[model samples]
Target: MKRLQQLIRYSTFALGLILACSFISERNQAGAVERPWKVRAYIQKHDFLAEALRQETGIPKAIIYAVAGLESDWGRSELAKNANNHFGIKSKPEWRGLEYCKPTQEYNGQQMVTQNDCFRKYPLIRRSYEDFGDFLMQSERYAILKTLEANDYTGWTDAIQNGGYATDPEYAHKLRGIIWRYQLTKLP
Candidate 1:
């Protein structure tokens, strides 16, 4: 009886350890994709940040939130999780700030391919948002976005893609879909 009890306790401890390890790894790796609820929760949780950033930068709040969803897969990417680089922004020669390099997927004309790239690293989510504002604001390519009405999310989407923010041909459509799905326009 004593031997049987010891064996049962050992099995339980091993099982618990396996479960705990798996949970941590999944969270550290897949994040929202592993837990479906995290995507939705991430969007909702950051709406206010998007709104404030919009007021500060003149980028539409909906566009900011939608881009966060489309760019980072609602904060599931490793950069988003580890570095708070929600926009998939890259390091530029002009930028002398901190950065994080990671593997990422991008459309290479015909198909998607993975490449290791360097992206801006922020210590906090808000810094990422603020930097996103500065990023676009400082770029001449994105200057056209300023002429469009602040609430014109569709136009903003087009401008972002046309400005070469993303290589994916469907970037605008995907961002629009994210906004519609989340009903982000309803946010103040």
Candidate 2:
């Protein structure tokens, strides 16, 4: 009788552990499923503005959307939420606007490094979008993007990565993946 009781106790403990592990696994899988939905929702919320900015600035809407989505983590990053900086536009010395400081990681050719960086802040989300458009239009490094056709998202991504817009070596590939995954290339 004593051995049976011990066996039952061990079995119950094992069963509880198994149940807890199963719950954790299910939650993780649910998170994976929910992420694409979040990206889709982010795209839905900002697609019209992306199209408008493209029309006004001559940048491809797909490129704008994919870049913003990737940079901002589907509008869920701290910079996007706190500063409305969807494109991760860092604050330059010449920037006279409000700034938000946060820790960020950048690839420095050798490896990734973390540093506290200041980023531009905007009062409205629209201002963020407008500033991103103006940023591309005014930067000589990105001038090549203007020559690409409006729907050439892959070309724009390559140009942006080549122009040193991001330190990530896989920046262009990641942008292309996002553009393709979300069908952003269909945007006008």
Candidate 3:
């Protein structure tokens, strides 16, 4: 009888451990929605950024898609949901010297509400793309990018990751993978 009781106790403990591990695994994988990089989304949502990218960086549409895909998986990123904060610009609370203003329904495009908060909104993806480009141009962090501006999307990406835009350990690797996957360097 003692041996049987011990066996049952061990079995229950093992079952509980398995259950806990399964729960954790499921939680970790849950809510991971993949957003495919689409040119149209960029055209509609980030048109302003898109144009600026072309004009300033001379990078084509395809390259932008590849870069954004690796960065935020085409803007379906978890962080993107909050304040449309792609490119992971950290809050500069010290820059609170900037003015604050309320947004109106008609006030479209990216606007800085407070020194620390910026909202990027667009009626279409193209607008979003262009606005994103302009965003980097205007931001203090990427100001150096403007000066060294060339069509070096690869270099731009590396600089962005190195500049502490994101804490992701594999950010640069993932970005490179996406860039290679789509061969954005060749697309006109």
Native RMSD of candidate 1 (Å): 9.7
Clash counts for the predictions, in order: 0, 0, 31
lDDT of 3: 0.55
Residue 35 in candidate 3 has what lDDT? 30
Which residue pairs overlap in candidate 2's backbone? none
Local lDDT at 82 for model 1:
84
* Candidate numbers sorted by lDDT from highest down: 2, 1, 3
**TM-score against truth, every candidate:** 0.75, 0.78, 0.45
lDDT of 3 by residue, 1-188 (tens): 99999999999999999999898778658833233446447435765665567777554554466556654556776545544544433335433322223222221233323233344433344444555565555668766665554556667767666765555555556666766665555443
Q: Cα lDDT for residue 143, model 2?
A: 94
Candidate 2 lDDT by residue in tens digits, 97-120: 999999999999959999999999
Between prediction 1 and prediction 3, the one with superior lDDT is: 1
Q: Model 3 clash tally?
A: 31
Off by over 4 Å in 1: 1-40
